[model samples]
Target: MSRIGKRPVDLPSGVEAKVSGQTVEVKGPKGTRSFTATDDVTLTVDDGKVSVTPRGSSKRAKQQWGMSRTQIANLVTGVSAGFKKELEINGVGYRAQMQGNTLKLNLGYSHEVNFDVPQGVTVTCPKQTEIVVEGADQQLVGQVAANIREWRKPEPYKGKGIKYKDEYIFRKEGKKK
Candidate 1:
């Protein structure tokens, strides 16, 4: 009954998927990733595609059906093409630089904010104001970008802070003179 669950995730060329118990592992040229589905849903990889079906007609089963399918799809996409997120700093003195495994941030704060890059995720600063997060895990890449953005979220008035490349901050009018 789940729309997303009904569609099978097709494996791209040169990508391989293996099913072991409730877990599905995908391997590709970029990297390898795995996902474990809840018991409420059954996972299967056949031919060149993966499918998910609910074990019963319960709410939890249906919930897991779609979620499990998406997770599996993300695993495939992640291993194949990987994932990336970009952030931009928009303040006068705000900037970011990478020091080996650490990301040094100057977000107009009293002291510089040093963000330690976690395993499985690569943080790079192509420009002083641009940050790029890359990884095979979609969640980790997104979470790393979010954590960096949290240091200095864009303000509504001047919109001076860090934000995603495609994000738009709503501006508010200044106080009356």
Candidate 2:
């Protein structure tokens, strides 16, 4: 049995969800997000909650059961409270700032890298070493943060690069004399 699949996703007060065939759409104060699941699972909405069930007892159906349920739950949480990802710069010359709809990053490179912020997502820099990405869609917010971090990934030795707020850098021993 699928433990997670059995639990229905409860809709918040201001959030609403609609299940049509294999597609689920959720609307809230932040924005509207939708997902289309595979045929292996069935989506149902009732009594201010949404549920997912497998169409059959096959292996694929069972695999999708729990996955579909979590997807629906993400949709609910995303629309209601939205999502965010924070990045921290750890290098001396590395810094970030916002310019209109663009993000200016100085990650020890000879030239400052300009990152264009996409629509539906908001990128902000409260400080030179901090970057915050916020949006209704969790995937888009995470992707934007990843793209920004790609310019200067954190290194294991000096750890001078961009990294997540809660991420830990595993230190390695230097060369022996």
Candidate 3:
């Protein structure tokens, strides 16, 4: 049995889960999310708890089953407590700001990059160099953060670019004159 799959997921208060067919819908204070279990995986909700089991004994099936369960659990937690990602600008002229529903970023480019913020997610710049992204969907939040980071990944030579607030990028020394 899979250790993570064997553990039951505890549903928090104010969060409601409904299992209909192969799709599981989770509703909470933040928002609602739904996920479908694979054919080799089965999920059930009982008394505010969720359980996942494999439909077959094959190794691949078991792996899918465990992954399905983890995805469902993350969805439940995300809707209940939400998710957050913090980013920091390292370049000299790099900065970010919120304008209406869009996030405009200046990453030393000739023109600014404007990213549209999707519904159910919020992006804020607490400080000039700090950015915070929050949402009820874990996947969406993470994807957005990744997209932002992709604009200007940290360079190994100078460690200058956009990166996660807690992320560390190793720097290499420049050539001697």
Candidate 4:
């Protein structure tokens, strides 16, 4: 039995969900997001809640059961409260700023790197060393933050790089004679 699949996703006030065939669409104040589930599971919405159930007692069906449920839950949360990701710069010369729709990053490189912001997502640099990504889609927000961090990953030698706000960098011993 799938524990998570059994729990229905409750819709909050001011949020609306519409399930059609294998697709579910959720609309809220932030935005509208939709997901298409596989044929292994069935989706049903009732009483301002959404539920997922497997059609057969099989491995694939059970797997889809939980995954579909979580996907629906994410849609609900995404449309309602939205999502956000924060990044912090740790290097001395590393910094970031917003220029119109583009993000300019200086990560100890010979030249400044320009990052073009994607649609449906908002990137803000409240401080030169801080980056905040916000959007209705959780995956997009997270992916944007990761891409920014990839330019300068935190190293063990000096830990001079970009990283998540709550991330921890393990310090390593320096070379000595």
Candidate No. with top TM-score: 4
Q: Count the backbone clashes (under 3 Å) in each candidate.
A: 0, 0, 0, 0
TM-score of each: 0.95, 0.96, 0.94, 0.97
Q: Write the per-residue lDDT of candidate 3 for residues 41-156, one digit (tens) a residue.
A: 78889988988888889998889877988898899889888899999999888999999999999999999999998888899998878889999888889999999899999999
The lDDT per prediction is: 0.92, 0.92, 0.90, 0.93
lDDT of 4 at 152: 89
Please write out the lDDT profile of model 4 over residues 1-177, one tens digit for every residue.
Answer: 999999999999999889899999999999899999999999888999998999999999999999999988988888888899999998888899999999999999999999999998999999999999999888899998899899989999998999899999999999999
State the lDDT of candidate 1 residue by residue for 1-177, as single tens digits: 999999999999989999999989899987888888889988888889999999999999999999999998888888888899999999899999999899999998899999999999989899999999998899899999999999999999999999999999999999998
Rank order by lDDT, top first? Answer: 4, 1, 2, 3
**lDDT agreement of model 1 with the native:** 0.92
Model 2 poorest 10 in a row by lDDT = 70-79
Off by over 4 Å in 4: none
Please give, for residues 27-144, the per-residue lDDT of candidate 2 as tens digits: 9998898999999999999999999989989999999999989988888888899899999999887889999999999887789999999999999999999999999887888999
| lDDT score, candidate 4 | 0.93
Clashes of 4: 0
Name the candidate, 2 or 3, with the larger TM-score value.
2
Error of 4 at 87 (Å): 0.4
lDDT accuracy of residue 140 in candidate 4:
91
